[model samples]
Target chain A: MRYMEDTLLHHLHTNDTEALKTFLFTIEELPLLQVFTSLSANEKAIVFRLLPKDKALALFEALQPTAQHHLLRSFTDEGATEFFNDMAPDVRVRLLDELPASVTKKLLQSLTASERDATNLLLGYERETAGRLMTPEFITLKKEMTVEDALAKVRLQAREKETIYTLYVTDQRKKLHGVLSLKELLIAEGSQLIADIMSHEVIYVATDTDQEEAARLLNEIDVIALPVVDRESLIVGIVTADEGRHILEDEAIEDMF
Target chain B: MRYMEDTLLHHLHTNDTEALKTFLFTIEELPLLQVFTSLSANEKAIVFRLLPKDKALALFEALQPTAQHHLLRSFTDEGATEFFNDMAPDVRVRLLDELPASVTKKLLQSLTASERDATNLLLGYERETAGRLMTPEFITLKKEMTVEDALAKVRLQAREKETIYTLYVTDQRKKLHGVLSLKELLIAEGSQLIADIMSHEVIYVATDTDQEEAARLLNEIDVIALPVVDRESLIVGIVTADEGRHILEDEAIEDMF
Candidate 1:
């Protein structure tokens, strides 16, 4: 293992992209984290660039906030903006919270207009609130959409959405209306109207609700994502079960201490 | 509230099934638990009988083990047998563990042949093992099946299964082959073969693995269920995420004491 690490480091220093790619080809998540962290920020950037986009995103997501900050600094401005923009809005907010004010401002300015707006919306919320903990990248179905139309919409945008498991149904004003699981849509007849089958009893939290409370609700309800609404019952964002688990884990650690 | 409770109890004592049915018509899971627990075991059984089948199942599932046992004792043998048979194998095992040995034997004997076999398979495993924690009620796809055929099979059996979110692929000998999520199946063309889309690299636990370890793996993978395999790699059962979360919460509480 020591000799393998030395050779990998040598390859990194020498820019042996071929050898580094070969080594990284089958590297699992845990070792990838170790290798990424052990390298200097520049070296980490070099190695990260060699990774395929999906793997790079996965590695970036697996990283600690400090490591993520260092990796971001190592990237070119264009690269930084693109990579940061690709991350879920909630993740971007968490990272922004850890950075110095000037760096955070620069990064925020670098985001795409839509990404910047989403981040800004989250940033406006108080810390530890549902607004700060939700991802704005969610798919919303119009109540009038046919099942086929909804499925098509989900398929077209599924790659970029935070979760396609639970789709929220919104009205003309984007007011929270109803919710249905993707499975519900999949099993329904194509011609069926979404409004006819979608559940109107949506369990949701206001944007200002405590994040821990939101997470507990997620657990109790056993839903893939909990919709976070604004004051007017407009669906603003969603807190996923995975994010809820993290908050619960963090609270557990805090309790331990 | 006291007056309402008194009226409800009067209805229960008078065996006013019509009034009890009306009362339970829109009762939610939490309040049902409260009402079920507050009643005498015999009264609980009467109220339970008045509930719709789905609601009764849900209420029984939501009850604490002690409450479940008390309610079970109040049930007539035929009703107990029918109800016991309807539960997923894993849940039956958990409840059996809490009962007196004679009661456990009676319940086991009351199960249908298939349900009894499934429950016995789970009961055979040591406590806190993956085998003991998994439900045998999972849908398995054949590698050669067309996606359409698989979907049909899932739809037909979906009601009886513990979860339809994650489906395991198994070979002729019932050896676990690959796995895929329902979303994957729904997105793919009907003509596509399961072999082409199912992920060959399945993350699973051996039958003897610790339940906590299995639950942690389920959390890490963020999958709906984790397959548990026996010595010959035969897929025995699966642990759903909801069960995993319960195990995790129980462990957290255990730590606090």
Candidate 2:
């Protein structure tokens, strides 16, 4: 891997796109991110430019928040918009929070309306609150459904969901009633009611709850996802295991800096 | 919350078990764990002794590993046994790793034969590797079964599983062939074969892969559990998102001290 890292640098130095592509294809995302970040700023840009769109997005997400901030400054406005548009909402806000106000304003305006609303809703919360980190893209279920019906709902909507693993059971008022993992749904008899299998003890965090506290609870309980609710206990968004991980990774990086 | 914290502490000082229980019932696990941990050693013992068995076990698991270490030494043998006997396998190893050799040896003998074997497998691995943290408790499947048959298998076998959310499809030789999330299983038509719905792309790690790396992959992909394989490519164990959280928590606590 070290040999490949060096070779990647050598390829970048010589402008050998074919050699770099061969090397990158031979490695995994973790190693690719490592090699890309280990390069000098100019080399990093060159390598990043050469990456395919999906790989580029993955690499961008994998970069340290500081590294991401640096790249934001270096990219053309169109390039920045492309990256920002695909990035996770929390990630986009975190990067924006670190840049100069003038720069952030210009970048922020380029976001599409729905993305802007989602990002702004999170940003409106306190810096380290659950609202700031929770993704608004979760799917919800209704209690009036059978296991088969819920399954159909999840299938139709699951593609766009941040997580369909833990489906929230909510009322017409959007108030949470119970929580159910897809495991329970899968194992249940098809005609069985979701309410019969769903657990009523839904562990949730308020929108204003501290992010670390929420993440810690999420971890301790070993749930793949936790619901974030408003003060009235209506489901608003969901904080996922990945976001909890990103918090830890960002903290570790912060410690080193 | 501050008032409740103060009131609980005061009640503990006054030996007010009734008031304390009332206060505890009104609050959630996160705050209860925090308030309990903040108490004096004498008070902690008093409160712990007063706690119901389930709550005590929860508190024991919620503690920082070092605090768990101190409690092991501080408690009477009977008290310590109750705590140790049911602690999660990976957590047991972590706590035992921090104790004196003689203490660990004595405690090691108390575990059931199967638990001892599982812990020893993890102990045999290098620190920070997947083998050290991977749990031996997991459910595997075969691809030839119908969804209904698989669901029945899951229902019968699910209780002992560390996770049934991400089911592995293995061949006759116990070689993993594909992966299927419970979501996919739930949404599929009941008569369909498991092979038809299961994904061929399985993201996994060898037993010796870095725990953090495997964990990062699991988190990035937002899977409930990650399978750990041996050199022979047979599934050995699974590492869970909760365990990932535990690893990060341990790291954060280590940095603090």
Candidate 3:
């Protein structure tokens, strides 16, 4: 298991912060996550505090919710907000679901308006449904848009969207009509309309659709992303394959405990 | 849990093959899998027998291996050979790993030579590692190739390759150089060399690296496929995100049991 309590832990105890940072940086993220689990609560705190802010945030977000709760308990309100607010919407929702009601309420109040709204939308949907697991930051393009125009739109909007791997084409009313992969867009003639080349067979999930079924479809089809829609059949968010993986893993962890 | 015992089960009871096939056609694959789980032993055999050959193959491959074992017991050796030889490589390996040594031997003998070789390669590695989960059907391209050339290669090899989302470029001795997404290739000028456009941060797993760790890396990075390497850092096979999701789900099911 490579559970060797080597000089790296020794470096943390010896108060050699420089050596400790160097050593920790050399270890990959998953192994680092494991290493933190093995430390004394005090040792964990000491080592966690010594990490650079970016590394600490990345490592903290990767942790299971119970471990995250323990770490959050040690933080002041401002410290907690900074850490919690930076997490992906789905992960943030999961952490909030686990924390005390009062903490969740306060954390909700502390978030930026948009992040708070997205989390609320996900939470409002019934648990164990696609709505609860979707990320709200999805890009929607018009069905009539040219491939050239669509690619430009994606480039401009890509940073805010969770995934550009798969894009949806909706009518003016936001009803999803077709789906296109970024690969297809890149390969198409620039003058061709998205609707001409996009696959009209829209494999999607409704807001209240079962999450396990969604995960199964995502895995079975091997699509990098799938669109989630509300009752109006308007696109609301995306459930990336990566998030699908996390949902399955989290459920597995739940089974273990 | 839509556990309605409706007229479809009625059709099965009455031996109404036409009605049962018609009703089953209206159901989706995932729900069909769940329905199969609820059937009694004799009922399962009757319903499974009524399915068309293609539908039967898909349904059988999606089943849990233990359930598959039960079905195999009821089949003639010739019938079992037809069913066992058609599963995806990793799924086949997993089934082999679970069954009695004698059953595994018989199935391995019945497989095509190429499929047998691939199975042996994956089995040669320690279980619960990237090697065990990876499929050797990945498409490789050279760093010197133009974007046009690479895309052409992808189209020709797409049917056999596990994933076309991410492609790796290797040097003369098969030493890994960099990675480029198909999206990047599609958007780039067709004449550009792959080495010019690829990212140097090659996220990969060694052959004996832990499977859970590999799954985590694939999820965290949101990559559809990852390179699996031999001891000298040569790419041997690719592990797709689909496999990553299954590995996590299977582990979760194990924990629940």
Model 2 lDDT per residue over A11-123, tens place: 76665556765666567788887677677655654455445445666777776778876654444334324434555656444433222222223333344435544444313
Give TM per candidate: 0.54, 0.48, 0.46
The models' CA-based lDDT, in order, is 0.70, 0.66, 0.65
Provide the lowest-lDDT 10-residue window in model 1 chain B.
B95-104
Q: Is the docking of candidate 1 incorrect, acceptable, medium or high quality?
A: incorrect
Q: lDDT for model 2, please.
A: 0.66
Model 3, B115-167: lDDT tens digits are: 54444432335568887677766667898899889877876676545567788
lDDT of 3: 0.65
The residue-level lDDT of candidate 1 at A203 comes to 94
Residue range B22-43, candidate 1, lDDT tens digits: 7876677776776667776556
Q: Considering the two chains of model 3, state its CAPRI-style docking category.
A: incorrect
Task: Itemize residue pairs with steric clashes in candidate 1.
Answer: none
Better-scoring candidate (lDDT), 1 or 2: 1
- Those runs of model 2 whose alpha carbons end farther than 4 Å from true positions after fitting are A1-128, A187-193, A210-213, A255-257, B1-133, B145-152, B187-197, B207-222, B244-257
Query: What is the DockQ for all candidates, taken in turn?
Result: 0.12, 0.15, 0.04
Interface RMSD, one decimal, each candidate? 3.1, 3.4, 5.1
Which portions of model 3 show Cα errors greater than 4 Å? A1-133, A136-160, A183-197, A206-222, A247-257, B1-132, B139-160, B183-197, B208-222, B251-257
Provide the TM-score of chain A alone for each candidate, in the order shown. Answer: 0.55, 0.54, 0.54
